[model samples]
Target: MSDWRASREAVELARLGVSELLANVAKHTASRRCGLRLVRVGADVVVQVFDESKQLPVVRTPDWCSEDGRGLWLLREMADGFGYMPIPLVTDTSYRLGKVVWFSCWGALPEAGAA
Candidate 1:
């Protein structure tokens, strides 16, 4: 993030979002293993978590009193954009259905004109 000149606030938000998304996978999915990817596209940074489960994440009304079920809601509220999509998990032996949940922090890179 520092290499890309992301603001402190953006870095913090990205960290929090990753934690929340991974936590959700551990709590809800049958498989504990997942894949994580981070990419920089122009001035934006996108983070994605790939899980074997085909189920898409749902953003529900967060229960302030509860410890669970608030991650996705908070992520959606904080990130510049967030989404999930069904993807093909192609392995050497088989093809499986999976999903990737992603969130983007816009302007994570400094503008070309900025010093």
Candidate 2:
């Protein structure tokens, strides 16, 4: 993870984004389980959450006092990239189908001679 140039602040933001994604799965999806993956592509760290839900998440303009529907928005603001992909199930399973929602955080480069 450190090889990706992930700063302290970036790692924290990534954690928050993943937490929101999992919360959404627990609250919205019918599946009882989910998967999370963190990977580095170049200078960016990608956080992915997988769940058995064909319904894609939508970005909404919630009321100022509303407590819900802000997770994706927060992720969009914090992460450099955010998106989802539907996975087709080839075998019979309880989930049947699923989706993978992902967000990427661009890591900050270290200053020369700082370390």
Candidate 3:
């Protein structure tokens, strides 16, 4: 992720976004096993976090007086777009912890550059 800052040009913003994402996963889901997925798709850098939780994320006002909850909000503002993808909703009665908190940022590539 060295180029994270270089690529985003808004290094601090990108760093804050990534840091908050990790922290949220630890605090909200509290899952033991988790991982990050970074993908370079066209002109966007897609950041994905996978965890073992059934809770779906929503955009809500995190108490400003508190020390947290501004992560997703900030990320949303900084990113081109972001959202969660639930595991394949199958007909079976089996439930699974296969959801991801994902976001995309305009990379340093020309395609994403200001027109």
Candidate 4:
């Protein structure tokens, strides 16, 4: 198995991003169940959250007075890139339409490729 891991900052950001996404799931969707994946590509780490809800996330302008709606906007500013896309979810019975929200950040160790 690969021992690769993201940098501390990257991991921290990923944690925050995941928390916000899961919170959205709990507040906006009927089901809170979802899938999470972390993948490393070169010097970057990608975090993906898959949910059965077909509704995509929107980046809203920050309203300091508001309690919500700042998660995506803040994430976009902190992450190298962030976006969402429709995806096919596999199940025992049939395919379901869902979405994968993802963000990428630079995190690999400088000696990642070194012996």
Query: Cα lDDT of all candidates, in order?
Result: 0.90, 0.78, 0.68, 0.82
lDDT of 4 at 74: 95
In model 4, pairs of residues that clash are none
Better of 1 and 3 by TM-score: 1
The top-ranked prediction according to TM-score is 1
Candidate number with greatest lDDT: 1
Task: Quote the RMSD, in angstroms, for model 2.
Answer: 3.4
Model 3, residue 14: C-alpha shift (Å) = 3.5
lDDT of 4: 0.82
| 44: Cα error in model 4, Å | 0.8
Off by over 4 Å in 2: 2-5, 90-95, 108-115
Lowest-sum lDDT 10-residue window in model 4: 106-115
Per-residue alpha-carbon lDDT of candidate 1 for residues 48-77, written as tens digits (9 for 90 to 100): 999999988889998899967788888999
How do these models rank on TM-score, best leading?
1, 4, 2, 3
Clashing pairs in 1: none
- Is 1 or 2 the stronger prediction by lDDT? 1
Candidate 3 — which pairs collide? none
Report model 1's TM-score to 2 decimal places.
0.92
lDDT of 1 at 73: 89
